[model samples]
Target: MPQSPPTISPTFRLATQIEAILYLKGQPLSLDAIADCAGCDRETAEDALIELMDDYAHRDSALEVVEMPSGYSLQLRSSFQNLIQNLVPAELGTGALRTLAAIALKNPLLQTELIELRGSSAYQQVQELVELGLVRKRRQAEGRSFWLEVTEKFHQYFEVDELSLILAQSPKHNGTAAITEEE
Candidate 1:
């Protein structure tokens, strides 16, 4: 017998929306991307996004589904960005910042790769970035390669969509953090 693909259930639709809101924020997302992640059809993913958009609109949320050069991203309504900026103190320092830039640029790269490029200190840098919620680590196959990627917070700090700048700024991942004055 030919195997059939699993269908998207009502519960699955809701879950997919939640994951979309969490992962796709400040980024473009294609229906196919969402469908791939949700393990459902593109039509189903589109339907779920439409439904989620309506739900947010009805609630008059501080966030919204926005179309960007990349695709669809859940972004903070312009009115709220300033308010958020005020909460994060300027004294946080740059160890986290440099680390953030490195991960944002070489995303999905292994921790060891980062360390090798930047040296042993890179581990401490990654640790600090992870602590600040600016970066995340995922264990991959082949002896737990740590996958490094940026968090939503990283997006808000630079006010940019593409992460290419970080790479151009620092190709070798040096664990040494940079110190900068308040902007």
Candidate 2:
């Protein structure tokens, strides 16, 4: 009989696959998606996720697995946030930057007001920001309009308080008060 290579256990294989999927996606992934990608059942996927989470937790690694409302994601631990942020350059474009600045300056801003202030392009900017995990949109109580607010991720990524100080000191915003303040 010919010699054969040893086989990997399903649990180990599924755990490896799930880790790769989460790493590549860079976002939360539902259990169903993990199972589909790993070619395993839901129970297997859930087990793999738990295994991965525990593995990361026990290790002294800077990264961790987190469960969000949307799904599960692999990310740097809060303690490592500043260190990683310093290494990665910001990826926001000019339009997105402007939109974010506007929102950060006047958070809980109504979508209507944003559109009026930043033009129709604000819609696309908002979408991009949301995808980047920097902004969140919620339906307004009174109308079909949405309320735009910066998310915790935004604060983590940009250190909003620092940005706010910079913006306040900027000549452009020095004399200009927040739109909400005017009303």
Candidate 3:
């Protein structure tokens, strides 16, 4: 008899399907979006995402399924990003860069609060940032967790006394973080 493809569980198959969608999109995607693209229901998409998360968590793979502020994504594992460091530009990825920008915009931000805002994945970003000398992490004296601030190196690296000025001028920012620059 023609060998029937080893009957993969439906959930596993769905997760694999969603993985492909995430890979092709090259960005975070909501469960609903994944459902629509995969022609599956939202619940199934969510379950698939969960399954994918577990699959990646267990497999010895260099990629991961991470839930971002926007949605779920399949991307390079942060731990592996540095392995291929010599091949890529010596710069943080977009997600980490965004996290750094957020810290700069809100300097002296509490690490807990930053994680709450950016999600747990930010922990890795903060670590990378501290290693890069762009951010400083120090434990709070009180019972609270660590506090994060932009290092002096941040200003020199970005070449600005105030990053807010640069962000405010960006039309995409909608001027929400805008602060008046003294003439």
Q: Please report, in order, the local distance difference test score of every candidate based on alpha carbons.
A: 0.65, 0.83, 0.81
In the predicted model 3, the residue pairs found to clash are none
| Order of candidate numbers by lDDT, starting with the best | 2, 3, 1
* TM-scores of the candidates in the order shown: 0.41, 0.48, 0.44
TM-score-better candidate, 1 vs 3: 3
Reference-based lDDT, residue 81, model 2: 73
Give the Cα RMSD of candidate 1: 15.9
**How close to the true structure is residue 29 of candidate 1, measured as C-alpha lDDT?**
76
Which tens-of-lDDT digit does each residue in 41-110 have in candidate 3? 8998898789889989999999999999898889889988777655543567999998997788777789
> What is candidate 2's lDDT per residue for 113-173, written digit by digit as tens?
9999999999999998998789999999889999999999888877655555675777665
lDDT of 1 at 13: 54
Off by over 4 Å in 1: 1-12, 15-21, 24-26, 89-96, 99-183
